[model samples]
Target: MRAARYLRLGEAYISAARGVLAAPDFEQVRLPFYGLLGHGMELALKSVAARTGWDDERLMWLGHDLDWAWRVTLSDAGFEVHGARAVGGVIRQLSRPHHAQAFRYPALLTWPLPDPRCALAAAEAYLTLVRDRHG
Candidate 1:
């Protein structure tokens, strides 16, 4: 259920993050963060599942819109990860030694925009929130 929650949040965040990126000023940059959010969700899902022992199929059965749920959660948390490089960077950031223990949703408010590195940071917050509340 926790994993499902994160996935849903991730899906929702990606859409809003993309909207921010596509805003008049950011339109020129056109970073395309939705893809990055999806990638981040995929990576986070796999990683969290592997670590938590929730198989892919089991997670799939959690809900049909889990991806959307993840997106919404991330958006509510204010994470704005977008792009492949940004996604990778975020994952790396989250993978760092302290993230699993220290990252939090408020961190997203200060989270740098247009940086893929923030994806992992977002993931850490999502996972931590779910784990803390449900685990």
Candidate 2:
């Protein structure tokens, strides 16, 4: 299924971001790392929509709207939100008041970001839950 493929890609992106975390020049790539994570999560939610028989056009409409995609995913019966809090928090932190774009482009705002390790773990947990339940 496309969802499964997207899920795999999502994990790959998150994994790639995590690898960058261990690098000595973390600050240099910090922005890109957040972008990667946001993208990975976006794919996760879009992939879930794909699983629900939504076409590419519908998924495309979702764009980078993580909150909307997440809402759609949660509409599924028994989404098994084992680590929903963390993922939800990250989504909130990324989607509301600002957007994933901030991570990709320079912004005049400054705000605390979620810990990379914890964010990675939460992402993995969320993906695992989705895979186990629907992948």
Candidate 3:
């Protein structure tokens, strides 16, 4: 997985999320789209980390940083920060200090379908961050 390819997938994930959210019938399709988007984002992150030869410690640090960013952004929007806390806890538990031989794609993929309002906010924020950073 090339870094550029991962970045491209990240972009596509964000785009797909935007498309799903912008549609009027999002409720009907949110689960699958969210799952796919989450999987894609997780893979993209792992891909980029692998391509960069990041040590497990670095990956764990990156996950922590992203979790912090997610928490801050969600808090700023008045959403319950517990979801971010849970995600962060999982990262702490799963990420190895040296290297993660097996990628944890399921971490984000297994998250329950978010409440519609929170999901919309999170999708918008996630997409915006991806676009601004990767675009």
Candidate 4:
């Protein structure tokens, strides 16, 4: 299923980010790390939508809007996800056009990137919440 595919891909991106962070020239790869992180979050949100019975068209409607997807998933699930508020805040920050756009193209945006470790923690927490609730 698409949800499973997204979840797996998200996990892979998180792993890739970790690998980059462990390398000697970590500074050079900051953009790629955040890019992977943002993409992972996007995929994770889509996975949630799929879990909620959204078809492919509805999933595509979600597009790269993490904030909207996060809100809709939480509302539809009707449960408080651990670290959801904090993660949602990250999602909102990343959802801004420039920030999200940065993931795809070179941009001169100056927004602060969330700490990779903290971001991973939040993602894992949120993913766990989704699994516990849906699986």
Candidate 5:
């Protein structure tokens, strides 16, 4: 239940991000876009973990660590991702800034951004998988 909630919330954030990206002033709002995407990934991965019966305490331990969450989902829980490596590459790219609050805060640096489409696809698949298989 909690897992599905996280997945739904993650989808909402990503959907909001797409709206932000569509705006004319999108260049000036890049930070918000990045932040939303990172946070979305975080929630989606948390959903995967929670589906496996991990408690709130363990989930909190992960915090904003998208990479670890993705790892747990991919290798441990065995969620079927079409391009696991590529999706992982996207998660690892977002993990550092997200974990450090860099995306939400003003800790911007030369962040090597990955394409969100892969991550987005992976997240959607995760959401669907958890809802269908677990429920």
Candidate 6:
């Protein structure tokens, strides 16, 4: 039940991110866009982790570390996450020390932001894979 809820929340966050990314002036909103994308992917990874027998406490402890979640989820299946390189890149970008804070605050982001559409597509693919394998 908790896993299901996490998955649903992940989907919702992705959906909201997609909507924001679809706006005309998305360049002006890069912070929220990437922040939401990173967070959504984190939740999606947590959902996969939960399906692989992670407890709620463990998920919370893992908190906001998309790289760890990604590794754990892929390792649980003993395979690479297919069709998600763009999303993976974004996760790597967000997982750097204090990167989330830098993104949330007004710091100069030196890293290139992935195209929202491409990132979202890869994220959706990952979520679909998780659903198919775990559901």
Candidate 6: misplaced stretches above 4 Å? 77-80, 84-86, 97-99
Flag regions of model 1 displaced more than 4 Å.
27-47, 50-87, 93-135
Top of the candidates by lDDT: 2
The C-alpha stretches of model 5 lying farther than 4 A from their native spots are 116-135
Candidate 4 regions with alpha-carbon error over 4 angstroms: 97-99
Best first by lDDT, ranked: 2, 5, 6, 4, 3, 1
CA lDDT of every candidate: 0.44, 0.76, 0.46, 0.74, 0.75, 0.75
lDDT per residue (tens digit) for residues 1-135 in model 5? 788887788878878877877788877887787788888878877788788888889888888888888877777677877656766777888888777888777764567876655655655565565567666
lDDT of 3 at 129: 49
Candidate 2 per-residue C-alpha lDDT over 27-113 given as tens digits, one digit per residue, 9 for 90 to 100:
888877877887888888777778878788888888887777787778853354876888888876656423547776677547677
* Model 2 stretches with alpha carbons more than 4 Å out: 76-78, 96-100
Ten-residue region with minimum lDDT total, candidate 2: 91-100
lDDT value for model 5: 0.75
Per-residue accuracy of model 4 over 1-135 as CA lDDT, tens digit each: 777887778777767877877878978887787777777777777787787688889888877777787788778756577666778777777676423677567778677666767776777777677667657
Q: By how many angstroms RMSD does model 1 differ from the true structure?
A: 13.1
* Location of the lowest summed lDDT over 10 successive residues in candidate 4: 96-105
CA shift of 65, model 6, Å: 1.8
Task: List TM-score per model, in order.
Answer: 0.31, 0.86, 0.45, 0.86, 0.85, 0.85
As for TM-score, the candidate ahead, 4 or 6, is 4
Q: Tell me the lDDT of model 1 at 107.
A: 29
What CA root-mean-square deviation does each model show from the true structure? 13.1, 2.0, 9.4, 1.9, 2.2, 2.1
